[model samples]
Target: MNAEQHESGSWYWEVGSEQCPHGPEPDYDTQPEAWDIWIDRHTGSPQDVRICLDAPAGEACLQCSEDDGEMVPWESCRIREHARPKQGVVPNPGAEHQPVTVLVGTLECLDRECDEYFGDDGDEIPDMESCSHIREEQACSCQRQDDGEYSNDPCPARSLSVTGGTA
Candidate 1:
């Protein structure tokens, strides 16, 4: 039998050929036979076989399709989508009035208890004037200290200003 050695060092023999000179061996399996045929027909290496087998059906085989000139079976091998520049908003010419800006400034708090008292259920206080903890005319003393409680000192009221365009 004609003896052939695989990468694993296992020897196989062609049935009805000259017996292996060294010792008895099993008949060549279909996988080895196909591998030899593929190598011979495509003039490809063992590594090429691995690449073709590992690659998905419609994707490019790295070993055979690495060259730019080589043809890939898929329509496109690109994995990421192309990014385009964002478009800016265009102002409407038919609009009757221009945009206005409203500025609301709140009193800055130094004390942690005052800060929590200003917040509604852990969220920022929507309107500082609406909170019962705030003192309308008096300046902040910054002396409030207690857990889950508000002090008698009320934070100063915030000023509101509206600008831009005729109001």
Candidate 2:
């Protein structure tokens, strides 16, 4: 995925500003570096490539204006109506503006059927690498040993099973 459509893209460029708000003076670095610094502020770690932002209710609905200044609040700026979701062909404006009720940090595993990956205390199973027995025999796409040999534990299917058990 590219930067343009991501939340990070909003702060990816200094535009009319002379320097990044958090990094070395704008004079010390190139435009791209300034952008990288700006994006880093909203992220938890320096290595985090993407920052998931909640486009404030009505703020992210408007497209950035050409005359808009560099220091304006980008996260709250409305997304351009013409901008489309990169993963898919068409942009669904209706879906885009809907507030995301799910926050990342508080999410819990709810899959009832995934007893092997959960503990008696109703928490995610510890030692995910050794959960599945079958996983020991099958290598992952990286062609390495399956870490979760006892349970085949944390594949995409099993990961989501943490919440309310699989249907």
Candidate 3:
């Protein structure tokens, strides 16, 4: 199954496979049965290559009709819808070109009993990483290894991802 199809139906290339699910070693009479052919706009022009596109859906697909250029798995080969963009027209901005989602993880102590979590006098400690008391006094086994050497794990803080405004 294509992982990108769910994100966006737009495709960079149409991929097909014919490998068998039940394989007692399926017979391969040919050397390499599968192929991956991506849209190379530089190879053909709009006039020479008939191109169609679903502009609203932002979907563009191509197939080899006149010539045998479409790549398909040997077993199930069929002519798929062929689409190309007009010359000087930009291709679909596929799922890969969509805006990025950035998740920033921040650390904070979840244990209410830990003094440094809030602070000794009830004023919240600004930085838990700087709160050395937690490493010595609290249940932060991640601070050091059993042999007493410094551990690779960061401070035993509960990581939280928060947006600027409440959802």
Candidate 2 ranges beyond 4 A from true positions = 1-7, 10-67, 80-158, 162-167
**C-alpha root-mean-square deviation, candidate 3:** 24.9
TM-score-superior candidate, 1 or 2: 2
Residue lDDT tens for model 1, 35-144:
56444322232333222222223444232234333433321222211111112322244542322121111222212134644555687665553323323232222312
TM-score of each: 0.14, 0.17, 0.13
C-alpha lDDT of residue 124 in model 2: 70
Clashing pairs in 1: 1-17, 1-18, 1-19, 135-154
State the lDDT of candidate 3 residue by residue for 1-167, as single tens digits: 22122121232221121221221222345422321112222123323532222112233332221134433231111222111121243323443222121111112221223455675578866665433322222212333333222323334252332237766
Candidate order by TM-score, decreasing, is 2, 1, 3
TM-score of 1: 0.14
Flag regions of model 1 displaced more than 4 Å: 1-32, 38-49, 53-82, 85-167
- Model 3 scores worst on lDDT over the 10 consecutive residues at 98-107
lDDT of 2 by residue, 88-143 (tens): 22323444222111111100111122456678888876665322321112212221
Whichever of 1 and 3 has more TM-score, that candidate is 1
Off by over 4 Å in 3: 1-113, 130-167
